[model samples]
Target: MKYVLEIENVSKFFYGLVAIDDLTIKVKPGQIYGIIGPNGAGKTTLFNCVTGIYRPEKGTIKYKGEDITGMSPHKIAQKGVLRTFQNIRLFKEMSVAENIMAGCHTKSQQKWYHSILHTPFYKKDENKYWKRVEELMEFFNLTKFAMTPTGDLSYGNQRKVEMARALAADPELLILDEPAAGLNENETIELTNIILKIKEMGLGIMMIEHDMDMVMKLTDYITVINFGKEISQGVPSFVQDDPRVVEAYIGSDDEEDEV
Candidate 1:
């Protein structure tokens, strides 16, 4: 089957230290793929390479059968690929609705002159984007916080805003880095449901997360990486049972279980 994203022998390094060592992965549309590993397993590094924050030292990356290796981040994002950071990143002073509207600017039709002159077309596109922002905020349960400054919202709500912003870009593939990092159980569960909803909309979702229960519930397939190498990968059930996965990451879950 044709894949939405294909990474083949992709490698990256910093100061001669390998961050992604000949790693390969494939993601299909409507699939939720998880990347799990220890803290230094090169998960985020791989994301950086994919998003063009770092150019890969070797190998190829193809999206929809088109090679996109080493493209600029904004250029890549324009192609319907969007991501949320492991650390929450949002405009602290921007209203929740305004933040999401910024994401839609990439899809806005008016040119610089139109915006500068406040032309009728600018007004039209502005209204269109505003309506879109409102719809997304309402969908993510952020309607009440629509006018609130993003920094003033609770951490969980800020995260939801970020996801909403990413979705506002109309991504075909969404990459989330450690989306469940600091959430409480209830918040995590809610986030899980939201992610499932996104998947149902047919976006390819990839994430790097430490929360095993959340990852296991949300992902269709998972790849385990340790020290910049792939040690295990498959459906969640199979990866959960693999000895190598146990030794590397899942074993920690067992320890948490014991505690």
Candidate 2:
């Protein structure tokens, strides 16, 4: 099976400081691939490389069999790779629907002239994108807040808006950075179920999460890293039991099970 996203022997350095050492990870269609490590473990740095914010010094990144390493961030996104930041990034003053509609711009085919003149094509495109925005709002249970400013909503709802915006771009591989960072227990549970539903859409989901319970329960496979190097990788159960992971990430067996 062709992987949805493939990173082969990839490495990134910042002024001689190793941010992401040699690493390889493949995510299949509909798979949830988790990257977990302690703070400063380079998880986000790896995300940056994959999303084209930083080009790897070595190795390659492929999406659906196409080499996309070093591609511009916008170009990568146009090619069906979209991501959310560790912190929620949304148009604070924009209505929820409008924020999601911003994402739809990537898929729009209308040119600036068409929009300026209100051409038939632009009208048609507008309808199509608005329909998509409505669908996303309902899917994320944000219909009630459709006209509300995103900043006025709770943190959890803001997160939903960001995810919905990413989905609006129609991505094949979605990269989420610390998605559950500030969510409460109940909100996190809700987000977990929402992600499982997204997996059923057959898009590969790659996430860097500090929530070990969420990682163990939600990920189809996991890569444990330490100081920019992969320490262990396997199914959740296997990685959960690996000694190296225990030493580097999960606490010792003597401690109460945290992961």
Candidate 3:
């Protein structure tokens, strides 16, 4: 089967420091591919390369069989690759509905002039976009907060809004960076269920998460990285048991544990 996202022998560096070292992973449609490692393990760096924030010095990234290496972030989003940051990024002052609608601009076919003149095409596009936003709100159970400013919601709700905004763009491949970073246990549980529902939508989700329980529960496959290199990758069950992954996260018994 053709993979929805492929990172083949990819590498990236900052000055002389290697950030990603010949990493390779393929994500099939509807799969939750996980990337997990200790702090400073280059997990986010790998995500940056895939999303075009940093171009790999070597190897290639393909989406739907098209090479998209080094494409601008907006161009990547236009091609249906969208992402959320490790920290929440949202329009704080915008109402819930409006923030999601911002994501639809890329999908809008109306010209700027059309919007300025209130042309028929623009009206039609607005209607279509609103319909999508409403559907997403209901899906995320955020309809009750539709008119509230995004910043007024709790952290967990803000995360939901960000995910909804990314989905509004209609991405086939979604990259999530530490999605459960600040969420409480209950919120993380809710997020997991929401992600499973997203997987049911047939979208390929590639995520970097440090929450081991969440990773083990949500991921179909996982790649464990350390010092910018992949140390192990396989089904969650296999990865969880790998000695190398164990060493990377917790270190050998000989090494003194850091406080």
Candidate 4:
């Protein structure tokens, strides 16, 4: 089905403690898949496995139909899989444009020697990336702060900049961890619209988030995990109605019978 990512029966452990167990997910082109669960549900761990931050001990991770299980993170990224963290991970002292340009190196064809010698190949490629960087900045509404240090921008603006940097890699699949965290209602709404625009560009998205309203509104499908197990998965409506979801996140009203 033109899947961009296929994860099957994946599992991970930390000192014999299972962090993810038998997890399977398939992401197709232009799909926005949501990963939601309560705290400590191994959502981030799953992202790590997919992105190669932490290798899965079992099963396979396939990107673009190639097995990427345990591949180095850079190799995975070079294959057009990119992600953003829940915690802001921008270069605080760098200008907004510089931070994004850092992500463009992977796309350049010029070698370090060419750059050092100021060869035409290096300058030509450098100019192309500069234009592309401006395009991305304008696409994400960061042109006004192009020369500003990322740390000087507002929290919401900083978040946007981080996302722009990730997109600078020109990925086919974007994995976002809590992109809406810490933003006010207005900022969240803006972020929502921005995500919609990204979807229009035909990029598949896999996101780990806690904002129920955002998840309900933006995701085409939802995967609910708890304590490293996939408890429920489907559209938002079914996930919201699933009893296991309630028990895992909202807690159950019924108590155990007396032994």
Candidate 5:
């Protein structure tokens, strides 16, 4: 299978403290890949590196066979890579529809001069993007809140808005950082359905999540990291049974329960 995102021996450091150390992983096209680890295990750091929030100190990252190791965030995003933060990062003052519109900026064809002069092409593009925003809002079941301020929505709704915004970019590979964080059980289940829907749309996903139940249910493959290094990786069941994975990540009690 063709891999959508590939990282080989990638490492990153902050003031001499290594956050990710010689880590390697790959997400195959159309797969829901899971990255699970304890706090400070560098899961978010890896996401940052892939999304160009932080440049790795070593190794290479390739997206669709192009080297993107040190590219800027905007450049990487333009290549169809998008990520959400562990904490919901929404334009609080913006309406839900406006927040989703932000992701369409890269795909907009209207020039600054066109916007300044209100050209016909600019109006046409604006209409097209607004249609897209509505489509995205409907996809996430957020159409009712389209005109409401983002800050007025509940936590789960905010997360849905974030996902909708990311989808507006038309990304091929979406990296989600703890998207289920702060969500209720029903909301998490809803998110799982949305993720699978995205996979059906031919988008590859790499998610950093702590809810093992949700991960096991949604992921095609699992990668476990501990202390900035990959400990084990395989199909969910295989990784769940790996003893080293249990000792280093999943506690022995959970291992026994699985057995």
Candidate 6:
């Protein structure tokens, strides 16, 4: 398989508390990989480590065959790895279009002086990015709400706006934390469609989600972690049937008595 991201023996410690334990994983290009675990299972910590939020205590991370371990978050993002938080993080007062435009800042070449003076190149770049933003808004079906304040939109639409903003970065690997949180059935279905559309666009995705139905339907491979250790990794159906996985995560009703 053509791997886009690789993590080898990665581990993290917070003042001697182990958050991730020698975690190793790979995400192939254009594949939707799911990371599922109970709360405090170190899933978010793993995401943080991969995205440069925290440097791992050991092991290495590579992207496109280049060592990216210990890089800054901004640098990782520049290398085409972008992530969204579990909590919806939008500029409450900013218009939906403006919020997306903000995400394009890293790719924008218009310097402060050029932006202030409105130089020809600045105008050209601005127009180009604006057009791209419009395209993304349309793709996510948010064009009608483009001018609305992000905080005023419904919870589901706000989540869509977050996805659109993430797309504005044109990332090769998108790491989403609970994108389906706070959504109704219809919204969840719509979000699933958006995720599939993103994968079809050839972007590799690694998502940490608790919704098994969504994860099973959307992911090409599954990795389950419990108490900061990965218990299983394989195709969804195979992982679902693994005895260790069931024991660690999906406990049977009768097994609850033993616990």
Please list all clashing residue pairs in model 1, or write none if there are none.
Answer: none
The C-alpha local distance difference test score for the whole of candidate 5 amounts to 0.92
Instruction: Give each model's clash number.
Output: 0, 0, 0, 0, 0, 0
In Å, residue 169's CA in model 5 sits off its true spot by: 0.7
| Local error of candidate 6 at residue 191 (angstroms) | 0.3
TM values, all candidates: 0.94, 0.96, 0.97, 0.97, 0.94, 0.96
Model 3: per-residue Cα lDDT over 1-107, one tens digit each: 47999999999988989888999999999999999888998999988888888899999999999999999988999899999999999999999999999999877
Candidate with top lDDT is: 2
Give per-residue lDDT, candidate 5, residue 203: 92
Off by over 4 Å in 6: 250-255
Query: For candidate 3, what is the TM-score?
Result: 0.97
**Over 4 Å off in model 2, which ranges?**
250-259
lDDT of 2 by residue, 35-124 (tens): 998899999999999999999999999999999999999999999999999888899999999999999998787788998999999999
User: How does candidate 1 score on lDDT?
Assistant: 0.91
Indicate the worst ten consecutive residues by lDDT in candidate 4.
250-259
Candidate 5 backbone collisions, by pair:
none
Q: Would you list the clashing residue pairs of candidate 6?
A: none
What value does the lDDT take at residue 227 in candidate 1?
Answer: 92
**Local error of candidate 2 at residue 99 (angstroms):** 0.2
Which candidate number has the best TM-score?
A: 3
Tens digits of per-residue lDDT for model 4, 32-72: 99999999999999999999999999999999899999999
RMSD of 5: 3.3
Candidate RMSDs in Å, in order, are 3.3, 3.1, 1.5, 1.7, 3.3, 1.6
Tell me the tens digit of each residue's lDDT in model 1 across 1-259.
4688999999998999989999999999999999999989999999988888989999999888888899999888888889999899999999999899989986666788998899999999898889999999988999999899999999899999999999998999999999998899999999999999999999999999999898888899999999999999899999998999878854666688888
